[model samples]
Target: MNLFARCYCRTYQKVFLLARRFLDFSEPDLLEREGALKEDLPATLKMTGLDHFFLVISKFLFDKGVHLEMEKALKERGIVLTIYSDVDAEPTFDLIEKGVSLYKESGSQGLIAIGGGSAMDTMKAIGARIANPKKSLPKLGGVLKVTHMPPLMVAIPTTAGTGSEVTVAAVVVDKANHDKFSINDPKLIPDIAVLDGSLLASLPKSLIAQTGMDALTHAIESYIGHSGTKKTKKDALTAMKLIHEHLPSFYKDAKNVEARDAMLKASYLAGLSFTKAYVGYVHALAHAMGGFYGTSHGWTNAVLLPYVLKAFGKSAYKKLAEISDHLALTGKEANPQTKAAAVIAWIEELNETFGIEKNFAGILKKEDIPALAKHAEKEGNPLYPVPKEMNAKELEKILEETMG
Candidate 1:
């Protein structure tokens, strides 16, 4: 990046960080337990006087009947439920519009998203459309465009990643343009978040590994970013510690309730950290890959994280060293560079342990590098507050490395 542009980006990030204090970045009312969905969701809905609400879920979970118990409980409580299970691995503007139409026709007064990041993002985008009928999804794509409050929003994360349950942003794909973007605003934060550990029991081992690494990426990226605050750093460190200690165990044994709960909490804390501090090239690149190839977001993050950190080099040494110390991944006597390298090595080890590919060799086409790098540069630049400023050419080099 040019000196002028780099200075402008840093100045913008500093201003946003300063203004963050006055924003209502509140944590959701948390209902956490093994059976919160079946036992508590109904009662909570009744208490909130929501007679009818939209229940957004992924088709995979809906097909598996994972939501049956919750549906039965809601039925027993006389809380009318409208199910929208069209959400896929990536949510698009058209899909969100379909959901908005369904929500309006169903007479739903609130929204409850039950699945992974895609489902939660779908629900949030639907709410954004409903609240801002005058603005299209593209127009609402940047910062704080959803000026009005959406309907009462609740998020239930079935996966231990993405932390869409507590984030202030909703990622939506524009399939027509083959683009992915985030609609960011404080109003998009969920009013309630249900952390049910039992829901994770059925997740595949690969998913557990991917999502666990995704949470870890969130922590590291936010912690290393220049926009971090005291609270964000504290939360990020705590999240990293939890993921380091529990992710491998959870990956090996999905039935471990304690590990499941800890991972869920870690994901939430990572979300809290990154929502304020923001993520950098890893997320931007991952989003671009997701938009183009329909790749798994968590898996892409897991693959690109170490490479991006390595690219950051000296700029990220101090923060990565702090993370290494926090996770006890290196000896106390290690220098900052050594500690940072250890942190990157740890991420690579985690990926190898999970059987994730070291690069995107077959998945990412050579021809797509320029477009992908451009998309990543556009998404990241001013908003991300990365420790090192990288332009399109620089990001393309990292992409080339990932292309193997």
Candidate 2:
């Protein structure tokens, strides 16, 4: 058979595998048995900031709050919990060092990270460092570089984006050099993921918008990216459908717990999809921009999503057209380019609905375009399954357009 046929065959096989694995998803009775394991002494550590916020919220909600539930659950199991809050956004090498220092000082047996991607990544770095005490984080960059297994790590994501809670990757920055790199290891996937929407009720509107878009991007990119498998496509499409249905409503009505729960579930599904299929140009560019300017990843992607989708063009539009249908944008506009334009237009409209900017003018420097394009290409090519290979010159033009 031809290459395309072989790829489809593999995809079908994966779908069957996924169907078999779906049986494990129903575990209604497992929680009570876990209560039996309370004999093990608990030594859990999570990062600082959101935990404090969670504590304050826990007071009003009592047992309903995530922090309170966590404390109660740990207490039942006899686990001592510590909060390491020195972690900051755009977790630099220095910040990771501080976290590692704290983790060692605390001598915690396990980790419970509560926050956005930054806190989770910092916690992952510390877990890896604690497992392999002598190796530096920079040395752990790239795929499966971390051979040592970290302690039991549970992730409770406060934000509904990044899917870092379920993914097997951790990003760390070298602030001195404006370089961002990742540690990709299957072992890095969190042992537990808490998808409690109540945790997200306190998020600001801007955060809700940006992170929702981030989850949407993850689903779209995973669906259209070259690395897509049958299983990843299913996950991505499900996530896309959820985001399309609930994200805007959740953004407008933050108190809607049902919408919040759907968004969080969508984020988890998107995260799981991308972990296997990987992301493409949007994430590559967002990572570069964040590393260079300390910009927010979700907001950066929100700004660049439409432009990148347009550039993806014929190379990826077949898959994107399927996504347009998934978004319920079906009509007589059967042309691939037309469908792609419709998808981009829908995203542009979504951004406007959320008050996100269409340009990167103030955030991007003119002189830095070449460097930014070069770095983005270096990070994306061969690793990311970008449907169309983008050269520096072409990417420079995109940067210029983004600056508009």
Candidate 3:
């Protein structure tokens, strides 16, 4: 057998082995709040973020049943809760400052972050700022800059994407500079991650689609990135399989609790994968594009995923082939390249089914292409072990291709 054939055989065996182990394996200390919002809100709230916590949330969640239930429960427990629901998608530094001010003013002893990546990220930023009051936000960029850990920070993901609940990094936009930055530190990771399906039950289908795709991007990019380890790859593979099988169902029926639960689990697994393995061009560019255009972060990620995978090509063939196999996108007889291409085609088809746009024409500016490309490059280098290192010219072409 040739190199391709050997990889095929190995992947085939590994798939079965992983399937058995993946189902049996347990994650470290997760708070599964399936009916916690309805049945045990006070206990759940206290268990996760502790009493007197600040809830950094989105307007959607704030208006929804989850926050209401939480408020009622916490109030019953004599737990004074402070809510800051002014969080915007792809949150800016100004937003972070606003949250910080609220957190301090509220005199909350703990933190509870609800909603998607933006909410969680904003909460994380607030926690970081409180812990490192002397350091500016910009000074906290890059890896492990957090000297103080936030008090009892808990993350409850309303959307099954971004995996911000488990990740050690938070992406905060500098809207003034028309760019984005990250706060990377192990301390930034939430003390607890509460996966509550009730929180996601009323999520809009568009949000479900966007956030699901973001989780998919996280799993795919982590699996294919050069930094992937044996453990991370296993998590990524399990996450991809779960996401591929369940995201569509969850998207179609927002009330499908089973599907929502699975997707949320997948999101958590993907978060674990990417936090350790790291993401690639998809995230790098999505961050820049989102910052510059104020586009939806997950939508940009959904649009750019296939293009970035295509760029990875042979460099990520083995991993892509494995993903294709897990998703049943290709036959065992297929070569690695063929399997990889099939995965890409499947992704494109998936996007089409969900009505995601392939082009970024409305979102991209031709003149901003250079800046976006350079920004992506700055983010991709050193931090992310992308399969391919994209230079400015190459990235510009990508931006141009994405342009309408």
- By lDDT, the best candidate is 1
- In candidate 2, stretches whose alpha carbon ends up further than 4 angstroms from where it belongs are 1-69
Please give, for residues 193-246, the per-residue lDDT of candidate 2 as tens digits: 666666677778998999999998998887887677798899999998888889
For each candidate, how many residue pairs have backbone atoms clashing (under 3 Å)?
A: 0, 2, 1
lDDT of 3 by residue, 24-118 (tens): 22233467868654345467655554568888888876766457766776788778778888875767778888888878887889888888888
lDDT (Cα atoms) of all candidates against the true structure: 0.92, 0.74, 0.81
Q: What does candidate 1 score on TM?
A: 0.98
Candidate 2, run of 10 with poorest lDDT = 26-35
What TM-scores do the predictions have? 0.98, 0.84, 0.89
User: Cα deviation in Å at residue 397, candidate 2?
Assistant: 1.6
Which number leads on TM-score?
Answer: 1
